[model samples]
Target chain A: MSDGDQMTPSRPVRLATRTVAISVFLLLIAGALVTSTGSGLAVPDWPLSYGKLMPPMVGGILYEHGHRMIAATVATMVGLQILVLGFRRTDRTTFRLGLAAFGAILAQAVLGGLTVLFLLPPAISSAHAGLAQIVFALTATIALRTSLFWSRFTDAAPRAAVEHGLRTRASRLALWAAGATYVQILLGAIVRHTGAGLAIPDWPLSFGKVVPTGAEWATDGVLAHFLHRTFAWAVAALVVAAALALRKLDAIPGLRRLSTLWLGLVALQVALGATSVWTGKAVWATSAHLAVGGLLWIAGVLAAVLLARAATLSPAPAAAEVGEPQEAAA
Target chain B: MRTDFRSDASKSMKTFPASRPLWGALVPLAFLIAACSPNAPEAPKAPAGPAGKLGTAVVAGRVTLEGAPPLNTRVTMATDPFCNGQHPGETELPEVAVGPDGGLENVLLRVTEGVSGVYAAPAEAKTLDQKGCAYSPRVLAIMTGQPLEIVSSDATIHNVHAAAKENRAFNLGMPAPGTRYTRTFEKPEIVPFRCDVHPWMRAFVAVLPHPFFAVTAADGRFEIRDLPAGTYTVEAWHEKLPRQTFTLTLADGETATHDVAFPSVPSA
Candidate 1:
């Protein structure tokens, strides 16, 4: 966006904002830990672990209650972020973004509570996991928007970016990639929550076949696993396609760097996914896979937002500048 | 709109302290989150078991199906080659073992209520053997706080994941044959025990306080001997059917008979 519309906050404010995103990402890893270690139902109470605010952090209770404590902390951080935005009372757009983030985090916390209270129903648990990505992306975006880099970043003129329609093309591709990545995360959540991560048993191949069929199709576990694997490929393909398409474009240097990072994250995600399976869903490997998936999702979302912003980068033109009939038709 | 971001950025650092409100906000939320859990079980409320001489009363019963039994789904063990090799080609689980006379097998009978006195757990640990890649004694009954020794006979990797809610849940892997693991549950709940390595392998563990419990045999006959003479509440539980609860009274050296039939379940 143009410098005039950019929301610039000080370094400390930016760091405080990024801290919320970092904590939420850490919370995501803890949630993954709860599922990876089969500890989802370890803490047998709502909002409390073993009826206490803090139970003996032994066995599975460690993962389950650890997630809760982090979640509680995340909620507080979100509330304080909104309060800080309000206190500044400058950058009204960021204040609104903070308000939106507050709403999302609250919803995320309530979903988490319901997931535990209801004994980790696959649907609620999956929703809780899926929303975590959104919450992280939101907070991350707030942090991104408030950074000095964002304030200083001004794009080339619309006339330059509009020719070849590279800006429009890159933005569309990035949005599609982001959407696919989010769906892939949801599918991964389903695979985790339904106890389907190991349903196929054999990694890189399902029951020693390219495509598993027959009786396994009738079970929820196999079905969830198959869908997740299938959709992961789709996500990877979309991301690479976006990155490749953006490579042919020009004038969006920030987005180009992000595209490369997105590609690298996707490759790491695939390797982690396989390693997680090969390790028999080991706590560390599976948790790492999920953690990497969280990072990949953040990058995907950031790329999309950045590309979209860059596509419309030039400040809104005056009424006299609307006479580019060729560009408008294209 | 006049926007001077450089000056605004300088002003923001002076305006905000992020930690103070965060700590203040967390305290109230913590209290609210803990509100619903006021009476959650601390630790399986003092183990309850029979604490007197074993009586001679016997409760014999036959559980018959009122209608046709549901078709047990074909269990696929293709994921684990060892399990798949043990039972070749599409094996149906023994969940719905119905005799010609409509007698149902694997129904668990427990005296859920009216059994008095806190009994001490038996010194001898109950063995839950995993043979033929399936949990033997598919429906097991044991006292709370009684040790359960899990032993696998298959020379393959297996893990016992007891998906217990009331009691602490555990997932222990058995990497080789004859690997033994012992655990004692503290609460009275039907724990669904399964081998995570073999998804098709599953069993139910009935953790009861007293010893007045029996599982239906091949012919659907269940006999629980040594139950004390008293009016006791017996619960008949089948995995797929609604549980049946009834009261039974017995005298010393008396043999009481109870015949129960569960409602028809839809065929697969």
Candidate 2:
């Protein structure tokens, strides 16, 4: 009845949420494929491929059309998820989040079509990509919230008063890490859409220095590339700080493991980012880099949510007389 | 304190319902693997048409400049030191090449109208070379469905960016010398290719439904052979001059000769 009371979501609702999350992940990968292979304009006409529903699948058309197909599938899955959540789940937060995801996916589809119809304008394409990540995050959040682990963990555990400050700090830090990572990913989208990936022409060092020099500093492409790299370092630092904070808390059973995982993912992401520049944006390296980036963001958000749950369950001093020992048993 | 909480949380976590296995995760992976795999079916080839019969009529002609040819500015390759070093002194880009007596080279000539039959594109590929940081045969013509082989001959990287309005645009990177990339345009368009790395390197290609287009040579001569007898409008285009078009009628077993001249303007 209360926020601390665990409400078990129906199996169907959980399954649908998980499905939407996976679908969103796949859609993100498809989007990455389109950008990586330079196949955004492979299918010039949208909604219909070359004036037909099914175009001759070849060359860039495969990536473009396949992206459209994956998008459509994800849209359908989101629609279904929203229906299940609305009918079965009484909790308004998850229901509304599902609906919001639906709206985002619809907007994303429109943006995708407009991007093709308008000939891959940088703004529209970048927005489409940005929205995909947001939608993926939303779906992942819903999936995590609906999971049985989340429900039981929040309901059964009564955090000790001693752990309250640490949990709050960890939660806020994780939230900051997630927000910073999203901003970095958006910058990455700009760098990619503007063809700024090769602006620096060298990695680890921009134009053989920590910062761009001379004409490289003046060019927009080079500036964007440099910002992306700079922001990456900032994000890496934030991830490390968040990981350390979570490790110290160690109150949540799985939070420590998730933090370690974030460290590994961030390291892998940095390697992939460097390899992307070194390999001249090789398709595989760049695509993997994007996928890992998305995963890292997801990990950050999940850690924040779990820690916030722990913070909420921290025993209140005034409620100490209200069955504290039974709550501890839980 | 942490161990006490951990034991309690693990016990409660065990009581929690089992999350559903991620079966749906495999669907996207399958789709992605299938999309990226090389074993997918190839695009259908363009339909084959009857080959040209022997002894077909030919349209042969010369393109010339009527006045002093437009002076082409020198290409500055200072952005990439490698390209700049290739040219010892000032390197002038050959935009308008005019010989003695006003012979104009690099004029693109196409049969604009009156061709009706479907002409099969030759299987042999036409190559456009990137050497010395410039496109060889700056102006080229090909029939629709003909494969274009873009070969990079310079050590520096060059991206062949085809800016086509009617057809799909492609930007491909050739990172090493001797790298050959092939592309085919399905629609008729006058596509311009530029190197984004070296902004000054430019090339134009005209793709037509029929194989009746030709680019004028150094002596300003171009011959469109195997054109069936017909009254057609031939259009001549020069990069620096206005397009000129004229109607011509070719009779059976007759060789027609026509000269198209472009009025030249002084360099800016």
Candidate 3:
């Protein structure tokens, strides 16, 4: 290993990063619960519940307040992460990512407050939900960058000139997949918050046909639902292509395993999405759909991070020697 | 190695300078835990017992039609096969029901004004049943604070949605037969309830603050007994006709008969 390659994060920093990531994941689930239960207006106040530090936990109030508490805990975890990064990490990119996450969380909190203060206007509520996925992706990225596997992999140089083009192509593919998945997530948020989940009223077809009958396209609900479904198909195609590209690259087995896992998650997410519509947005199905959507997004982000890290390592003769045996075995 | 990593992280968290950043995170969290640790206070109890005097005065009335009643449209339950199968024959919508004697059924009669007293809601729940993809007793009247139990008798799923202007709106799904749900309205208003799953199924609920409300029977007869006598404006509302009002002054123990007639219009 080169002297510069040895600069992986200490175990403490990596663990802290994972903690923040997990906290953000839990926060996402809690937020999804609030949306699923339609409890956004339970407390009817923000920053402070019912004009006090704590509000009565009853009915919808419990879900809404519980979501706030989870969000507050995540914010604190991220804040601690930032503090730790400032003191211990010298990597400018990681530090900046931490700062960006903190800013995203603060903005998310304000958006959440406004969503309640304004009685959950669809635009603000959708934005709040969308921003949560973005923040989760951010934290997930930080976790990936600080993991022991990432440190070990990035420290090792690439071995084959033959692997260079494949790695770059796979990284670009993963990035596209991640970007498309995020757009799909945002579209889904719009569909959900705007009460358009059941607009199409049928799965695998729109209104029992490939295209809805006349004037249906003009309706906002139908349009949003159609576009979300269409985008999901596109995202699925992109993810599948990325997974195939990553499989051909000579990289760490962990990255290969994660690529396969991403494929599986995307498949499960599609089933969940279908069930969400088929059941007319049953609370359990819809909530699970959302949770799986978040997980799919994290998987995509992790894949992109790993591929991007692979793209940076210098080519080495050992990698070329190792690639021949793997190619022959395949 | 993973265990060592966790312990090392905890050690770092402990040994990290007890400075502004560490305190900034911990203090608010500590305060949050402390503030939210207490269980939520119990909801305030409702007022005890009726706040009105008992009297023997009764408002007896019949709702008669002055013109031809609007034709009731036959409801099509094509959305759900179960609902459709339940009614092999045509089921007429109960928007307006007129008796052979020009007496109106399903007309809601209530004391609209001038009689003021706190009347405690009955502990018994008024049931609104969803059967054969239709709301039974299409027009219902209940005291404002009385619970309305909604039960579905259909094998198919039915979503009960109450769209009330003056009360909290609730939308619930009953996915199976015998599924029961209850809700209460705190304000006096005419709430339109519908089953979204069966778009044609609809009902209306007249929530009054007092018990001086009744729906006209099949024979167009209605009676509201036990009224503390005073000048009261009684209003009769029919779903398809303009409302009719009658003003009457009653003395203690006096039974007043005020018959109302609604001039029906063309079907909507």
Clashes of each: 3, 0, 3
User: In model 2, what lDDT does residue B119 have?
Assistant: 70
Q: Report how far residue A3 has shifted in candidate 1, in Å.
A: 11
Q: lDDT by residue for model 3 over A58-174, one digit each (tens)? A: 445567779988887789889888888778753667777889999899878878866655446689899998899888988888887777776667755354334666777878888
* Candidate 3 lDDT tens digits, B1-268: 0101011113343222223442344444333432432111122225455586657888897888888777778865553567778876578877788889988898999988876658788889899998877899799999878888888787766656676767766555454577776678878899998754455678999988888888999989999888887888989988778888888988899998888888877774
RMSD vs true structure, all candidates? 14.9, 17.7, 15.2
Error of 1 at A128 (Å): 1.0
Candidates in order have lDDT scores of 0.74, 0.76, 0.75
Better of 1 and 2 by lDDT: 2
Q: Candidate 1 lDDT, tens digit per residue, B88-162?
A: 889988777788898898899988777777777786888888898799988888888887888878866555667
Off by over 4 Å in 2: A1-6, A160-162, A315-330, B1-268
- The C-alpha stretches of model 1 lying farther than 4 A from their native spots are A1-4, A155-164, A315-330, B1-190, B193-204, B207-268
Residue A224 lDDT, candidate 3, scale 0-100:
89
- CAPRI tier for the interface of model 3: incorrect
lDDT of 2 by residue, A1-330 (tens): 122354788888788899889889988888898889777755544454543445545445567778888887788889888888767743677777888998898878767766654556688888987898889989998998888887777755564333555776778889999999999998999999989989988888888888776777787798888889999999999999999898986656777789899999999999999999999899999999999999999999888878776766764445465435655554
* Alpha carbon lDDT at A178, candidate 1: 87
Position B126, candidate 1: lDDT = 87
The numbered model that scores best in TM-score is: 1
